[model samples]
Target chain A: MAHEEPINYYEYLRPNKKYPNVWCSGCGIGVVMGSLIRAIDRIGLDKNDVAVVSGIGCTGRMPVYMDFNTMHTTHGRALAFATGLKISRPKLHVIVVMGDGDAMAIGGNHFLHACRRNIDMTAIVVNNWIYGMTGGQYSPTTPLNARATTAPYGNVEQAMPICEVAAAAGASYVARTTVYHATEMDKFLEAAIRKHGFSVVETVSYCHTTFGRLNKRGGVVDMMRWLKDNSVGQIAAQKLDEEEKAAKIVRGVVCDVEKPEYLDLYQQVIDRAMEAK
Target chain B: MTETGSAENQAAQPVAPGTVSETPAKKKGPRGKVTVFGTWCKGCGICVAFCPTGVLSLDENGHPYVEFAEKCSACHWCDTHCPDLAIIVEPIE
Candidate 1:
């Protein structure tokens, strides 16, 4: 019966000499990690078949911690590498974990192309708005008038809508969830992975050290509180979209559709070649 | 009497074990023939350590290049946990 209880993440995580996690005490990355591991264990896929890639940022360090096929690629380039991996080996299931700056800024182009191509991969962007890894510099996803290390006087640029971008770029599946919605995160992640083409699951995270303190977001509790207070279902969020309702955050699967997958298409070419010569 | 997320009715379940990605594994064709990719590996042995079927091993640099091929269950632990993002899992067909 106890075995049925969710697997203990802390006990079985990839053994690291760095016992005390480096993230801020309330950082939700730990929770996200726990949920992901449990989901993978349940999916019945051989752990060996899964490749998790990450870009440079706080979240980039996540792959190093996970005991999976992982790569810590250059900042904002995790998707590009993952694209190569998925295309070169269409059989592989490649998932990319990236941060706001890495996925939405310098790596923006690759992210879009992956969606457009509908590459066989899943991208989980941990968006804390500001760049938490580089001491809270203003990022493209940083909200309008938010303070950052670079934006000492508050940011003038409006944050880009990542899920909208994903949808616009033709990601076959697009979902937005938050750390506060731990339950939803797991469900969305599972669905995203199962979806055959490019899937972008944006997980809004908390950055107490930089983004929270500099902006008015307060601490971890405040961030979680925002998630709870602003939570709305997909149906409800859709209604709001019609009525122009605006909440601090919305959580649900935004898009799920069938599209021509890049890797499978490449495999079709191989299939044809075998038949030809 | 039913197990939660126990490989049945997984869709309606609020949370199910998710598909682990990016490790290595072996797949048997209809005849059980297996092929392995030795390069594209960083030699990290998380796969060797996590294989529940006890089917994979490490060559040099801790990469999972050593394989007997026949004993493989195609469990995919090696494919899932290879730190270099190497390894591929597919049927030989």
Candidate 2:
């Protein structure tokens, strides 16, 4: 079968980087990074025109590999730095990458405020249910009964569904997809990148090295299969009864609505001040 | 009966050095080509494990290669899932 020229993913990646990324074998962070790169490529965005910011975690390391204007910020402060960057460089497409612990745990305040402010930026949260970089500690999104290094007897605390939190916090765009659903993740990421206001895309990922081994969840294949078997599209989820839906992760765009963006609204304030002068 | 026992043994045996039987060779199926950039591959086995069709397998060094090109469906799962960006899949012309 004749085919178009295959895309060289390395073109988007840093050329001088050594072989193999820092992520563990079968870690879902790579899949999410690939999807994000593909989405940016699809939109025809110039690498120079994009600013990728990340907090400290496995997810935080993503920007270091990309051939874009990147910044690795302090732990749980990616969005705060991204907000400042977006405000100063309104023309640049700011994308923030954060892990579950970075986004919803210590960074919870920044995450909520970023959503409530409705800034013109894209926030991609990789929810791996555990803090893989910090040695598989239980995170805010780690489900009840899930095993983590910090939660040896299984977590008694409830997990926070990030997409729902984003939606409730007034993000103009919110969606969720797993690494197993690569194509779907690409599409959702593309849409999230295109959204004008605060957009949050929660990528449910797996940390097979730490989380899987501790939980006895097998390897990469088993974890990917679990994601495939457990998640249901939002529309399909609505049709199911409460019990059926309870066990299934609802994927797809949870919320999307147009609203005046933060920076654009901020511009109005400047205009009023000028008029007063 | 002898064939059945041998087949079971083949299946049960751990992946050994220089063994090419990781993915069953399929003669009649959609064919594609998989290219692995050796320098980029981390021997993760993610692409091999997540492949919907058993078209990929890791060599002794843990680098992945297309073991059964004929079984490829051009799903691009391996291409997308490779953490190291080492693998690319394209339909054979």
Candidate 3:
């Protein structure tokens, strides 16, 4: 079910406010927001029935700008709050936005459990590879040997793969796409939201103001070009040798499996209890 | 700079293939005009960099201006992909 009206991005943003949003010029977070709006619009979801939740970060500020029902929750607790909202409302379309650090570091447990529970919700994890809001601190997804404010010399740890972790944690649907692939992102997001069980979309973005500057990755255009050149779709990546694939960010749907959603199972429990009473 | 607003003035010059760089195989039919909302745009140059056709160009201040509205092809690549959500590619009937 899609809207017959032509898509207008302005219709999704907060009325008469959040102009020139808090994101730095050329930030990828806004690209994700645009894709989200397009996906929701294409899916024909009413604004009032959708609840956008976000944890504290550059990405967290998203809910504040969107016109839909939104909650700006504590750092790393977006998924936790969203879980409660989803369970209680059950009918409201829930979407969670989190930064790399927020999802993989402080909120790591909640993220894993949310996936394991197979809750019906969409989580858009903006993986910018650093704690951009906190001034370029090295995040869990920062590539090995990348320079961050915390890892000035270099990061000793390998970057955590978000799609792989989500797939392993039992998320029914998992996909990855970079901001450069805007159309693909829109499609992936729509699919994730339409999935019956928990879905996670890892949006590979860059923190140009913080991460890019620290790493000397040039400017916004350069970063955008880099994303275009470095990312490879799953089908195309399959043809590349191991060494060639190692440097490329493999994108597209990682996994999709049909399964029972948490809410439906919970309804069964409630029905049984009522019958016993 | 003066030819910035008028589509006719900008379209007069036949775009040399070499000068425009790699102009992707143009999709036939349904051309559009690119509109920019200055208030919302942060002038990130995303629309300019990603426009499949050289239909957009950034001014000195970095805001995008429709360079060749005739060649837009209504791709919506710049409009939908613009980070600021400050662009709209309206099809001209």
Report how far off residue A19 is in candidate 3 (Å). 0.8
Tell me the spans in candidate 3 whose CA falls farther than 4 Å from its real position: A1-6, B1-28
- Full candidate order by DockQ, most accurate first: 3, 2, 1
lDDT of 1 by residue, A1-277 (tens): 1012324344335775354455665566655665577567656556678889998888887777777788889988999888888777677779899888999899999988888999878899988888887788899998787899998998999889999999999999999988766657767888888888899999887788898898777755566667767768777776676445454577777889999888778879999999999
User: Against the true structure, what is each candidate's TM-score?
Assistant: 0.71, 0.89, 0.91
Candidate 2, superposed: residue stretches over 4 Å from native: A1-5, B1-31
| TM-score of model 2 vs. true structure | 0.89
Report the C-alpha lDDT of model 3 over B1-93, residue by residue, as the tens digit. Answer: 556757666545544321222344356676665677888889888778777778777667877776565677677787667888887766655
- Tell me the tens digit of each residue's lDDT in model 2 across A42-117: 8889999999999999999899899999999999999999999998899999999999999999899999999999
**lDDT (10s digit) by residue, model 3, range A125-146:** 9999999998888989999999
Per-model clash counts, in order, read 34, 0, 0
Best by lDDT: 3
Error of 1 at A94 (Å): 1.1
lDDT of 3 at A88: 88
